[model samples]
Target: MEGETKLFTREELKCRCKRDDAVLIIHNEVYDVTKFLADHPGGEEVLLEKAGQDASEPFEDVSHSSDARALMKKYKIGELVECDRVQTKNSFSPNWNNDQSQEQGKCVIG
Candidate 1:
């Protein structure tokens, strides 16, 4: 922790997408895995799909071994700033809460 890096926004991470500048977000933390692509046990395709986005779910889904978990630290880049998350078109859209469908407390199945 003595030489820990600073926070990085999602947008900032997305900018590093080229083969030579790959970066991934896992569990809200950034990891520059560019150099590790060739060494990745799962190969580069999986990492490419998760590039620039949160890969926590998929990463956990793979059930990486303890050795793989320990290897991740070598690529640690930085943490995501809580207030600087990237926003998609749907992120700002309004959600229906107490609308007519819920007035009668009934559910419709189609």
Candidate 2:
């Protein structure tokens, strides 16, 4: 954690996103997570739901769920400041519902 730092602030996220809905990116490329969060092994709301907002709450609120860690590793939805990692658009439209719940016995990861 020596180099660790807060990822993004509400203002920063808002500014980066410019109020738009978009996919998360680790490096470059479109990261088209738009339709994937719904199927993410961890329940969608964990990250997919808060798509464009400050995800600090859910990250800590659901600490007990391993899905948090898992999601972090795979998608690497780093600290709040990750908004700075890539450019954002103001399409801030998140589904938040992560409707994959309806799938039959999907057994979403922790």
Candidate 3:
């Protein structure tokens, strides 16, 4: 683990990635949420849009995996950076399909 990238706290990410787009590399999977913040169907008011210096609770309600959290160490990119878009719930936030609403608590992603 000596050479592994460091992990950025949720607070750290929230602080830097509000106004700009961010690539949240989780478990080798990535999520890009730049332009999507303003249009977020998850209540745009909930997400911070710029250096959320003291912002908290924005991402708390959202569910994420600890395995993904461990993987986060590989992607602690510096200083509110940007990257090519990656698959993220943001891009598909509006697509929370009700095709199987009865199957709540089930894994939504494969």
Candidate 4:
């Protein structure tokens, strides 16, 4: 009970991804990699690129060894909560409905 994982939304994580406040989402788990930037084996730029985004794929691609994985535990911050992410539909796009058009007879079909 004392070491329960924390939960954070995507927007909240994005806010902390700047150069000064950096956080990483690797394998759906958030990690405060800010302090590790200077000591990162791959360099700070690599982590910066993945700031505020899901880095599961790229992280797995490298096939980090056990030791590398263990080192990341120290920075463990939280885990992403599974939820129905609602995708906002674009309202700016024009929706052409021939039945509801007020511009009737404006086009010559000859």
Highest lDDT scorer: 1
List runs of model 1 lying over 4 Å from the truth: 84-110
Error of 3 at 96 (Å): 31
Off by over 4 Å in 4: 84-110
Candidate 4 Cα lDDT to native: 0.69
Q: What lDDT does the true structure give each of the candidates?
A: 0.72, 0.41, 0.39, 0.69
lDDT of 1 by residue, 2-109 (tens): 575778776667778767889988766789899998889899989987877777778888999999989999898887776543332233436634243322222222
Clashes of each: 0, 17, 3, 0
The TM-scores of all predictions, comma-separated, are 0.71, 0.34, 0.26, 0.70
Better of 1 and 3 by TM-score: 1
Task: Please write out the lDDT profile of model 4 over residues 1-110, one tens digit for every residue.
Answer: 25877876656677786777789877557898889988988888988888876666677788889998999999988876554122113223355333323311132222
CA shift at 36, candidate 1, in angstroms? Answer: 0.4
What count of clashes does model 1 give? 0
Whole-structure CA lDDT of model 2: 0.41
Best-to-worst ranking by lDDT? 1, 4, 2, 3
Task: State the TM-score for model 2.
Answer: 0.34
Residue 37's lDDT within candidate 4 is 88
Q: List residue ranges in candidate 3 displaced over 4 A.
A: 1-14, 21-30, 49-110
